[model samples]
Target: MHIPFFRSFSRIREPSIAPEPAAEPAPRLGGQLERALGRTVALLQYTADSHDALDDVFTEIDGRSRTVIEELDTMRTTMEQSRQSAQDKAQASIDRLSALSQEAIDSLTQLSADLDKRMERIGAVMETIERSSSELSLLAINSGIQAAHGGEAGRAFGVLATRMRNLAERSSLDARQVAKLLDFSPFRASFTQFNTTLAHSIGDADRRISGAFHSMSASQIDMAARMDEIEAHTRAIPDMLANARDAIERGRRVLEIAQAGCAEMQNACHGPRALAAAAQRIGAPTASGVSVLDSVRGRGVLRVAIEPRAWGMSFRARGASQPRGLDIDLAQAFARRLGVAVEFVERPWLECPWLLMAGADAGAAADVMWSALVPAPIFHRVAFSDPYVHFRYVLVRRQGEARFTDIGSLAGHTLGAMPDPAVPDLLHAHGVRWGRDSLQAGVPRLKNLLIFPSLTEVFDALCAGRVDALLLEQTMAGWVCAAPDSPWSGRLEMQAAAPSDPVFHYTVGVCDDSAADTMREELNAFINGLHSVPDYGQLLKRWHIEPAQVQPTLQ
Candidate 1:
């Protein structure tokens, strides 16, 4: 059943006629939403820029690493080529020197052989000359003897022959000394020893040079192999870099998705923020400071004023005889946090607001009063905390009756509602076409409207066909339309009303005093804190309240 006291006080627009555009400038709510969205967008942009900067840094590092690898590779190639060229030239020079050494050894051997042959020929000639000298000496001796036999005339001839014999002996002696001087046996032996030593020395030099070249060639091959490995490893670096770049690119894409999500959140916040702004404007007080927060002392029992008449709002549980509604649970949780026990003060819904306004000397009827959608006029007398929930109007009618599909359907039809402070004004504001100006004026009643004093009477009238249709909060109507115990259930068609903007934000109320301001601030802080917790959604779900409704309560 719909609670008469808890029904939304906002006037739902009649959709039969299109609303004409007002000449006034757009609401500040739009500007507020825009500024909020702009800030969110700016934050997202800043994040994207930061990501871009990081990407640029990584890209630079990758490029530098690549450049270093390339340079190393080029240097390795140049060094290998130079080393190979130098080794080739060195080997060629060694080969030429070895060839020149071999030629010198060969020429020395040939020269030694020629020298030996010439010495042998000279020795033979010396032998021949010696023999000839000997023969001449003998001949000279014979001639000297014959001359002596010839007597005095032959004496001169014999003297000449003796002189010749002396010449021949001297000549033979000189020839023998020349043959000894010309001897080549010792020279040939000495030349043979020198040639052997030169050949050995040349061979040793060739071996040393070849060994050096062989070692150098081995070292060059090992170095070339190492360079090749290094080059191959360096070549793999670009692929690794490409993989890193791909990872960074993927990260960038993820960042972009995050930015897009932020944008979506920004867009979604608009409707809620606008609704909050509009509701605030509607109930914003012109004057304040008539209440204070001292109504409740620290860690002491709290006096919370609430109406327990509603079915699912703030009523007591049937079996447990304990309070079990969204508002009651919230209040109990809040009291627990304060280290205080709750002192529930039952009061009528409409009169609950006066509890906060009670005088200090009167012992302040209650520390806080909730959860009401205070009318604009009440704001002059009380202060309200930030809204914790919002509600939209819905149309309720009998199932077989003409559907109350739009505002047009209700244009000339009679509507029923439990009397409330803001209902008349809201109805008028929505072009409800009421014949009467005020309910308390005691004027002739309008055939198009029915104001009951209680929800029971309203429902009784709805079931009795005393009213064509009724307006209620969407949640309340849904409950009523579905509840088996309610008379309107199954028989009533609860059609959702559109143009749901400018919804009412329900809040806890306080007197316009110092305590009221403090209490409001504290309540806002507590509510804000509650929204941040995971249990916030759990609490809403436990009470079957929509979690989305509480999100706009953020101060």
Candidate 2:
């Protein structure tokens, strides 16, 4: 009834191997060893699972980090482009403004010279009038004295003398009024002051914009360097992931060995739960923060609001719902820059501002408004990009009609004018006196003013002989005169509203509620990028309007 453990070992002699009762202790020790091996196997398994879990976490982190890195690279590229564009735009603007300033100065100088010549001509006319009036007055006085001496025979002479004196006096008054029209000192002073102020302001703006561009370029360079460092670090995520995977592999090998030995160590006393906790504590990585751009990149769509108004900046082609215009081009460009698809929503011109301001609770909204000719007061409600186009008033007349020589000629003739904010100023600048009355409360008053609902109506009136001439902006006038199908085509010609006039600027609008500050900066950056070429002029030309350079687009 005795069995000896390790009977095959040479250390124990076969004769000494006896059926002793000590076999009980041998089995007990073997059972404890098997339990201990089982516990070791469980611990190893927990460690392997922890390593695998940690590796999976790291793999996810690596993928997300790479996505972030890619987005950062895109941002860096955008910044670089924007910086370069800003610099180019600033330089171009400086050159253009300088040239324009010089052009303005030259024009004013020429105008001054012309005025001097006209004043000389007026002086000669006044001298001739004075000589004629004095001779007539003397002849009348001599005739009157002779008439008094001749009594009844001179009655007819007396009557003729009185008429001659009256005619001479009237001619002298007319000459004095004409002389009053020769005052050019005020215009010269105003031109000088405007030129000096504009030059100084332009110089200051040039310096500021130049400095800003330089600063932005430097910032972009620094950001690019920082991005490079971050990218280098992010690129190591794969290796880190590999190491984690290798750790899991080694842990798996160890677990396999322990699993094989589990039956031999029955006396194992450690708990598997404690082992798992330890493994988790040692294997897990610290939490990585979320990336902002990554969170938003999945949308891949940009929403835009556009007004498809015909014959203006934006319009839809006939038979096609798709929009075409400067705004559409700009919006498409912006979408390309963002690497997104455009979703253009049509809205009324008056509702564009509201679309940007409205929230989803109000139904729907757009990020920004495009192709708006905003006024100064509206800036309080939203932000505006720099002007991309400009327009000025022009007086259009029928060809072969008596050419308008002066502002006085407009007094008694029927003048067709549109109800625009800039029309009154244009009229006033031409020295054409007007008044505001209850007949048309908000419209300018002229001697023979004809109010119209629209510029098209004004042009139609001129062509139909309902009005003597049409008063409209140069852009619209150009459109009308150039249109082959228009009634005024071949019959109308454009003239300046005044020798000089101010221009109306057109700009884009960003809503106050839609990250307006950032949107303004981004929009401005995009606009600055466009200044590398004369796209503004090209766009106007494509639309059959005058180039911005000739009309001079303002910021």
Candidate 3:
């Protein structure tokens, strides 16, 4: 009989029952049969035990696979939503830019028209002056000629006429120069060309942006369809596992019948003694490999990567044994959920992602990075959890300095910014020119751009007058300028009405390895849970951070 249950037992040779020899005694032959029966019964029992273990493994794998599918679905949905939001924002920005450009053109046209009207009025005045000067010259010439006929008395009149004639000539010459300078046609043509170029540029930008978003939408649709196919495959796994389990069950029943036959044969020879002893030989099966979640629980510590000088986000005070900040509190809370102690790993802002990617191979690998980091191109390799907070950039200036009121005011002034690749684009978008030493085509003309290594240095430069203004995150700016213990407290203030573009959605980062998926999920759950707790809001308020709106799904 074919025994599917014995697939894992392929290495073990089937016991052979030899036909009885004519010289062999009946009792000895019976004993041989009984011993073989006992061995077969033992093998069947081992197969059943292995089947149970295999069933458990299949169930666990099915559950994990389902969870993975659900997470992927959530990710796909979130990505679609993010893409839609970005497209909407881009469109709104494009519309605003178009409107501003049109406004500029309208204002230029009106200015040109006003200048033309003024020039016309001036020209008319010049013509009137010319006519009066010509009449006065004619009168002076006639008086000079008539005074010559009146001899000595006429000599004085001749001198007066000569003075009047000289004055008329000078007035006429001045009028002609003024009239020539009043010509506005060239100015009007230059204005028209500028307006046309601006309109063309705006239209081209609009088309490019539209095409990009259209292509992105198409790509996202394709990705979504692929994800759906993957989910369908994932959904089929449990059924496949169920069918396998049923086959194992049927094999177990067949083994049970074979075991009965073995029992009967053994009983007929040894009165159930051999079968009872065989049952005593079977031991419990060893457990399957531990999961990443179980491993973390076993270790009892969750290492969190943190940048210590992130102002209101995460930081360590002087002489303090433990670090403190909004992220610290959140990390401790996450550790509490995991039933583990929180271990803070000191790392630079840019190095945290690399450390996580190193995984267990690195001595200082982190389970999660909870610093105030935003999703940027540099961190493409890292997987990020849902955003827990949102922040925007602001223009900061020294107190009593009213020159820097908005991003537009930053033009022609030295501006301090953190060393971020996105800073240049952000500045240039707001009409501030980048001043990098290396010349690049299409780059704005250098005004003054100073990149500081850290927020501390940036603030120091602003205070020391090395930089006229600073582009900083609103939370950090508020914390530094308003915190009672801060050295910059009361010395600087944020410029009112500053543009708040490029809002940052700060999220928890982890290595992209499959091993970290469980950790990422756990973190996402923890973050989602925080919204309902009053302490979370209080923590944000304490840190001067404005809590972001929680997504409906997370809520």
Candidate 4:
């Protein structure tokens, strides 16, 4: 009897062991199990990818929120300072205007008092003129009476007295006219009324002006108080943003936990799926074929090919058990997504792609090459994932070397570079020939070109003064010249070849085999997922990769 249930149970008990070759054929249950397992793993991976994207969005939002809060704080501080300065200026203007108004009022009052005193003196002078004219008239009348007593002799005296009397009358008339004209009683009363009205008007004007100033001061105080309230409210916005960031962080932690759970679930299905494949082999040995992804899962290890000396990308520190670099961290992250342990295979950068092309039986075969490899014509057989990081090529030279400015500056200088096809193409484009032994093809060819095997060796050549300058990647140059622990720190400087220098994209390369397409797609998904991850940027920072060296997008 062909018992299908017993066969399934037997396969599950010993998943690692292969089924006997002579075992009787069973149903196509193992093929179905494999398909189901593939679907489950795909769904879990999709979920993880979504989580990564969402986490990245949250992190961006958090960062922007912090920036907004900081800007708001700065705005609030500037507004406060401006407000105080404006208030002080306004207050000073008001005080000055008030003082000027009071001074004008005092001057007008003094002028009014002086005018009243002059009017009184003019009235007294008119009264004295009238009294003198009356006295002259009385003296003339007495002289006329004496002339009547003495006959002919008195005739001349009488004529003189008459003339004197006429003169006195004229004088009296003039004094009377002057007294009428100088009638200070009515004029003084009118002047007093005018002065009183002017004083009253000035007082009223002063009161109104004072009241207006007071009102203005009160409004300013109210406005200042309102502004204070507004500033206080503005100050609280940062705290609100902080709370939102905290919530986002908490959500991110939860998502991380969920992702971990999904990874575990995916790993748990590997055993049963392998056993199902073994059973399927018993039914039809040629029908069930393990994919590269499946093979990696079966072994519970992802072989990551890397160039250990690619500084800032992948390198092992002295006395460290594990390698540390941006590529190293990224490779480990990709391995974690597969629910497998990582096994790093060190190789030269140029030789890394060949390791992926090596067959499964090869000792140094790798599932993916995580070195900072660029897509080139030489590696046509290798499948490259989407770009994860990018950097521009730059010229690195010793400090105070004024001879080098741009790519054209390297014309008369010995330039050092590692073995890269792109390097030669770049040099050729700039009319600079590669190789020390090669004849100068042009007049302004490079003085000499030294090709080293690795980045470390190239850097050593530059440091040892064997090379005049180095054509290097921006991130690597920055790491070697700017890192505090670097021996050449502060002794070297990097300059861009040009403002429009081509950006070099770094991608993961895999063998272009039947199973490699699936692996490449998965690697691309993993790389794309890291775009929003904060740790991706932090990892680069830890490796001394500047933010400017990183590409915001895959392109």
Candidate 5:
């Protein structure tokens, strides 16, 4: 005999990674490239008043980004705590259910022992009945013998003997029946019927007990199953909450980074702006001997709003050689072509007028602002030259994340971004909700946001696995991701804006200053000539900012 003879074999499956989906629609793909080109144009547009200011803007953006990252981390921690609490509660329930099941098992075991004892008691009663019946049969035999000895009285004796024999026979039969059933007799001679009824009653009790036991078992099993499910849910919840907390911490980090970056950018912009101001004050002589390019000479001075370097831009796919984010470039070219010196000023995210005097009538600082101003800025303040460029805000995530199809998909994930009053307000405007369970159409995809100070930190955290994604304009994100020497190249992607979003535009800002009439005429004329000029168009194309599409073969 072989005490230990066994064969074991295992067939295991190899682990696999997730695969990318089929290519997107041709139009969307082209849009991604076009947006990339826009970033290059944004860079070309930055002409700060001083190097210090340029540096400050970049530093500020970074500082804010770092702060945001920290916030994301905190949010993740909170979520984990919540999940752990739920798991503990579920575990306690499971323990209690197990104890109840054990109690039921013990009760059943005791009932089995009691049943055995009852059977033994009935056996003893049957033994006594058997002994009594044997003794009665002997007496009958003796009575018959005595009757034979007596003559006339023998009849009575014989009768008595017969009666005794009959009683013995009946007693014996009763003992045999009691032996078969657990004896609980009604008669002194035998307890067969009573014992049989007792046995039946015991069986009924056992059956009832079994039924109750079975019910209890079922209930315990169900309770355990429920606890298992609850535990699983609770476990997952902690991780989700952890992710959310991490996102918040990441946001805080972004803010810190942006704050530091802002300080640096401010230093950089200061020197550059001062230099420009000094040059202006000293009146560096131009060949034309114009202190400032007066409107009378040609078009006039065009005030260009420069998006700080901290914000940055992208360089998309190559076409004809040109810089990207070409609208900013065109604005500069338009200013130069009109024989006007460009006064580039840094503009705030929302209020460009504060940076430059665009809409004011009397104390206006700059006649026109170029950067990316919406139509509202133009319509309310002054007429726009035209919409020179378009942009979008996009969400960026890890490279292999297929779970997120759109920004809305981020609802389950921790989202890190700078807290812009405009963002939440915009969501509120479109009836977007602000709770974890609250989801509806037209709402921004992420209700749980880890707000940061700047977008750069958001990107940093995403790359570092601190947060799931970063939010920014598609045009900027796309270009920066593809730019040469950019670390994010090929590792980043753009998410399309939802239909509920408003169009992002870059337009010319105008003012009602004395130079308004001349400024308007020159700007319109400059735009008409901008596209046809080789240098201007070449600049735009160089930046990969051209908006054209070409289809690719699908595999």
Candidate 6:
């Protein structure tokens, strides 16, 4: 797709004097018109493709975000389940231990009471036996005294008394022995033994209790492990729930984003529909005219083009292919914006009078020329529009090259420059050693004047390692070196001039002709509208054009 370098402005015709009706009968919309329609179609297709790609990338990002959130939710739920299970198992163990401890205490208390009662019974029996023995011994002593008084007959009685005494003595002895045997005095020892047995029994019971403790501990450990296992298994429930919920949330967000993007796409689609309607208003076509729209229901053609005045430029890396300048891009943008077909025309400069006049000689000349123009002299029969951009200029050099220490160092190398009015006066004042013109002067001189139509081309040529030094603007210089992360950026290099002077303004001009009156007015009005309007400022700022007044965004 070749783009026009310039619009032909040959043989100026006199202005139309009177109000006249449209002269020509509209042809069955010609090839030019069809070409315009075709461009619109191509643009719409491009927009659709771009939007589809963006939507796909967005979907991928959304999916990844959704997955991460879902996993996080699952982790949280799993942690909660494990904590709760552990607490429950600990509580149950405490309850069981409490019951076992109480039961052991009760058994020990009952055994202690039984031992006390048995000791009391043994003491009572021993007391009763001792009393009986004492009574028998006293009776025997009294009987023996009576027998002694009765002499011979008393002898028998005394014998019997003696026998009785002996018997009583034996009985007393046996009773004493029985009393000793029953001697509840040792009941203390029996009680002590009972206490010892009770202690032993209590100890056995305590040992049993200790055994229960071990069992309880083991049970608690097993229960804990079981609880942990349950927790591990149950974790899936909450985790699944949380994951589902998070995934649903992510899905919802993606849907929202999709809706927004869809709305943009829909709006973009509407442009072509409106354009078609406008074309019809001007008597172009209808829905019946387009077969594609009839079947697909995709009416309207969306055409998107950067504004023609945009000065965005791109440069290659340190070593690479020749970077294309902005000339072709600008012309293409204009043609596309106007719904016209695009053509690329190369020219040495925008202001080549011979080039403009040459259209008469060669049928294939420029439709529009996109390049630089300094404040071309007023006498040149060309009237210009207000400047779109203005900037301070600098002398550029290859990166890491020898520095131009003094103005004199610029003498030997070829100097790159665009046509500017103030150059001669500035150069003379600075005593800078430089060139005049190599092509025209044909001077076999050290300084070779290199002319560039626009600084963009110069920077591009710089990237191609074409020129040693060229005049460049600061903002553009920054963009050339900016990394890929930068927006509206490129790659290039520059150096400060030993003497930086008089800034330049960018503008478009047309040869003074009354025949081009209508187009000229349109172009002029577009330029004048830039002053108060903020969007105009936005355009320049977007291009990083300096000397532009910065303003707040429209409400």
Model 3, residue 369: distance off in Å is 0.7
lDDT of 4 by residue, 1-555 (tens): 221222333233322344334443345445544443343333233334334444544454454456456756665666566666656656765675677567667866876786687677767766666666666666666676776678774776867677777767777776767666665575567667666766676676567656656765665666566554444334334433443454344334333433332333333345544445432322112133556677788889998888888877788756768876778888888889999999998865654654564311224467888887878766635778898877778889988788988777676566878756678767766666533324646546654555565677677767777678888887677788777876678888887556466667888887655556677888889988886888787777776775445344443
Can you give the lDDT of residue 415 in candidate 4? Answer: 80
Q: Which stretches of candidate 2 lie above 4 Å from their native place?
A: 1-307, 310-312, 317-320, 343-348, 359-364, 372-374, 378-380, 397-409, 413-419, 433-468, 483-492, 496-499, 534-536, 548-555
lDDT (Cα, tens digit) per residue for candidate 1, span 140-181: 666766766787637767676667767676777767766766
Runs with alpha carbons beyond 4 Å of true place in candidate 3: 1-292, 359-362, 436-446, 496-500, 547-555
CA lDDT, every prediction?
0.56, 0.56, 0.64, 0.63, 0.47, 0.43
Weakest 10 consecutive residues, lDDT, candidate 5? 1-10
> What would the per-residue lDDT of candidate 2 be over residues 414-498, giving only the tens digit for each residue?
5767534555566676656542221444443443445453345566668876667767656657756776644567988877554
Residue lDDT tens for model 5, 1-555: 111101111222222222334433333333322322222122112211112233433443354344345544544554455445545645654565565456556655765676678788777767777677777767767776777788766777867777777777777777666665654342422335444655565565556556555655565565555444333323333333443444344333323322322232323233433222222221211122332226324434555555443233312223524223554566556766766665555433333433232111222234465654555421223456654445545667677777766555665455555533345544454443444424466555542445544445556767765566666655456555655645676676656666545545445665433335455667777776655667755564455343212221210
Candidate 2, residue 410: lDDT: 68
lDDT by residue (449-515, candidate 6, tens digit) is 3444455555555555555566555445544444343322444444544324555665544433332
**Lowest-lDDT window of 10 residues in candidate 3?**
279-288
RMSD of each: 32.5, 36.4, 25.4, 21.2, 21.5, 26.0
| TM-score against native, each model | 0.41, 0.39, 0.45, 0.46, 0.41, 0.32
Report the Cα lDDT for candidate 2: 0.56
For this target, which candidate reaches the highest TM-score against the unseen true structure? 4
The local distance difference test score of model 5 is: 0.47
lDDT minimum window of 10 residues, candidate 1:
1-10
Candidate 3, residue 499: CA error in Å? 6.7
Best by lDDT: 3
Assess candidate 2 and give its TM-score to the true structure.
Answer: 0.39
Q: Residues 1-555, candidate 3, lDDT per residue (tens digit)?
A: 334644534433343333333443334344434433544454454345446545654664565476567767776876777688667768876786877678787878888788888777787768777776777877777776777677674776867677787767778776776767677787778778877977787777777777767767776777776575455345435434544554465446446544444433434333333333322221110111333455568778887889888887788867778888888888898899989998898865655554453321314456678988776655544778997876667788999898877777665566777746667677666655542332566544434555544667678878877678888777677777777876788899875333346556678997554556787888889888887998888887887666434332231
